[model samples]
Target chain A: MITMIELAESIYEVIKDYRNHDNIFITPENIIEWAKQFEDNGQLVLTELNKIIKETYISRVRAKEFIYEHILSYLKLYEYSSIAQFLIDTEFIDVQQIHKSQPAILQLLEEVLTEKFQVSYLPYKGFPKVNYIYFDDILASGSTIGRDLVIFLNKKNSSGQKFYQLIQSNEIKLSISVFCLHTWGFEFQKYRIQKEFNDKVLKKINWFWNYEIQNHAKFNNQKLNIAKPVKGSSSKINSYLENLSATKYEDYAYRKANTPTTEHFFTSAENRIRFENVLTEKGIDIINMIKGEAKSNIRPLGLINPQYKIFGLGTHFFTWRNIPNNSPLVYWWEVAGHNWKPLFPVANRGN
Target chain B: MKPSIRTYQIKDVVTFAKTNGEFGALSNMAAGFNLFINEVNIQSSEILYQACRFPLFPHIQEEIVRTQNPMDAKKVSRKYMQYSRQDWYSIKFKIMKWCLEVKLVQNFDNFSQILLATENKVIVEYSTKDAVWGAIPQDDKTMLVGQNALGRLLMELRERVKANVINKSTIIFPPNIPAFLLFGCPIEEVRNDDYFIVDLDEIYA
Candidate 1:
């Protein structure tokens, strides 16, 4: 006998008091527990209401707020400014505050440069560029420092291209100097090699080519003997570098190689096992064994065996005899411009 | 469109009798009468007299026949006559009240058109003047007759309508009531025993 209007009013009254309660923003476990209590009390409507409220509150509270606001700013002031100042004084570099930081690294660099050598703050229209690019600390991933460098480089090149192009054309020599605030060991080496190789390869191919090699050696620094297959032990250690799909293999082998620990290694391994199991279950005759030998303590090109020769990195063992009726690999080969293997002729038959 | 008696009416009553016919003589009599009257014209004086004269009928009629002078013939006749009128009036009032409560009677005329009963299946005649309007098959044997004999005439009316025997007349009820109230018999004597019938169009329209 209750009217729809009265039911709507009762629902509003139940929800109004708990609208902005801080307990609603408690952890997911606590929220779930509260929901269970509500359900037990025969309050199904209240349980759903509380779940929606808690989820909204949690989503509004952004993750990692302290790191963005506090830690990053402190690093820019004390560490980056001192490193920038050293770079300016040691070299006769013109340092300017195109972007500002707290306790101002660019300002400190400008002061040190004016005291040691000739320095001037360049306006947007008129700018002079000699050499040297500097940064504070380098991590395993070069993305952060690389992004900042690109922004500064773009600003320097905005006017006439005289500053950057003249330096690039070799009329004036441009040398990039990054003062190491801490040991940037492996990442620095990889970045330098990638830049040099990228420039050389671009000229020859008339296209930019970049690669990151994932060193699986970091997983277990000790060399793995591929000849021995240990029984009753985890095959995970052996095929740890094996199960990567073509795209994943390329990404891990190239870009993510520099920081393999940061990559979800376990998840990637599980995915590889799952993919291999699916292929095997489908009765694919392709090789399941990881190909190639581990050499010089590095799992090189031949170290891991692939079911298919992806990016032309490994050797093909057996081409499926039933070519036309073969699995999706045959279809892929046709799309990739490889000629279809002919059906066996009668002449090739033996008595 | 003309209405027809539901084919399930006999079966529904039979089933109701088998399930709920436990409460004593009146319930047994009502059930037996329902089965009997459905097949014969009880409105005819000859048939009603014969029916009332049955060995069991005397027991039931004795309950209705109240008299001060059993020896005086004229007084006994008047008393029996008055008893008949009172019984007929009570039955008519009870049926009318049931039709009203079930929302089958639309007006006073609708109430008059409805033929409801505890001991006979109910019927409603939408029109009074149409030819074949009062004609109905009282049983597998004889067809019903008479305009004032409400129960017999209403069944005949329904049969005529169903056979396309009457074009303009509408007959309602193999006693359609709301599904929830099918078990809710209001009459205390009949509550646990007999089935009641109402003509929906008579009240609802």
Candidate 2:
């Protein structure tokens, strides 16, 4: 069994930033005890797993820099050219917003932009319709943006005329400037938008983002074949992958990625205890957990209830703000008596 | 922390190939770039150039492929496994060596010296006789197309390499064996047949 001292040392080695300080959630001392819970046959060999947990973490420092360095700097450049008029998604303007969760990024953007540019939300009424730039942190499926655009365009004005109707009649051109796009989602939505609208409507869109990772169909197919079980563990992660039947999650297209995303593998303090309890009961059959054919006691993304066609586990995205629910049940989903702990603790649980 | 899976981006591949004088690969890349342009109508190789710079994350790659209606994820998996088993560097060297001997590439010595110079510049100094066409152009149109294609390829390479020289990490590519196949394969033929742009705006729109 690895000692608390050993676990702390291992964590420090990987998370160089946390050597002197504790993370917002898991501290080195806390992680040591947490590591003990995943012991297999009374042998706690979570050294590598601990390393993974630390490596996957994106501290607030890094997250802020990503926003400022990549996204905002580019936006500022446009502002300098006097061509940019910033608009945010209307969802950020919530009526019931507590603790100012709404428009936090916008507020930050405003502070950073330093009054050089204008940032506002829609029903952009009385404002001169310039190059309206919409900002969002991430785009996983592109469905969110599509839905948002549909809503924005369909919104009826005071005279009962919809914005989209006017645009369709060539009364006004609705040019969408998307920043921070996930390329796969972008392509999928791009195809849909073009099909939904005619050639003229499709011409007025521009996309600028930090980077687009490999999510093309051609590239992902190759990755699926090589997706392996996590190395050096007692869990049946590898066996589960090998035995996963094609028939399972057959209808849900997105679940087919085979390997769960690396981002979802961290353990929160609360989840660590619950997952350990489940681990004691289920005894490490990750494949069965994923299959979820017979057992109810599984991870959040694990239950495969067929509403979303969610694969039981794995997502590629990571953010400092919170672990996405779309990730595997083991990553963010936590429920008591289920013995389900998550790698990253979900923020605003039960919301 | 667990190390994320390392991926080779297009930029890394071009940097290596350009620096090492893999003329055949450049030809294939140029053809692919041309195909991408013909489909998308982008004036520059910036998309593929940018894509080349993007990392090839297996998780995203697997997800994207599986989502296809035909779902040839298994074939992709098999190919990936095959690639993992081979020595990537050895394969790269062998392919380059073969291309040189077969004259699929010309002006290797001159190109290599320029590429390897301390200043880190690519100087392509060649005469008309140095042309190593994959096949003889039968008509003026074909010859013009060939020249334009090669010209575009060379220009893009110089610009891309200059922009990307700062990436210090060494990268390797999966050998496109039967090296002639690499040069001859059109981008359209290799890309997902179902996935095509209905309108140029469908891509960026």
Q: For every model shown, what is its TM-score relative to the native structure? A: 0.19, 0.43
Q: DockQ, in order, for the candidates?
A: 0.00, 0.04
Worst 10 residues of 1 chain B by lDDT: B192-201
Q: Among all windows of ten consecutive residues in candidate 1 chain A, which has the lowest summed lDDT?
A: A342-351
Compare the candidates by DockQ and give the number of the best one: 2
Q: Cα lDDT of all candidates, in order?
A: 0.26, 0.36
Question: Model 1 misses residue B56 by how many Å?
Answer: 99
Residue A263 error, candidate 2, Å: 16
Residue B13 lDDT, candidate 2, scale 0-100? 26
* Candidate 1 segments exceeding 4 Å error: A1-127, A151-159, A162-164, A171-351, B1-205
Cα error, candidate 1, residue A101 (Å): 8.1
For candidate 1, the chain B TM-score comes to: 0.20
Q: What is the DockQ score of candidate 2, to 2 decimals?
A: 0.04
The CA-based lDDT of model 1 is what?
0.26
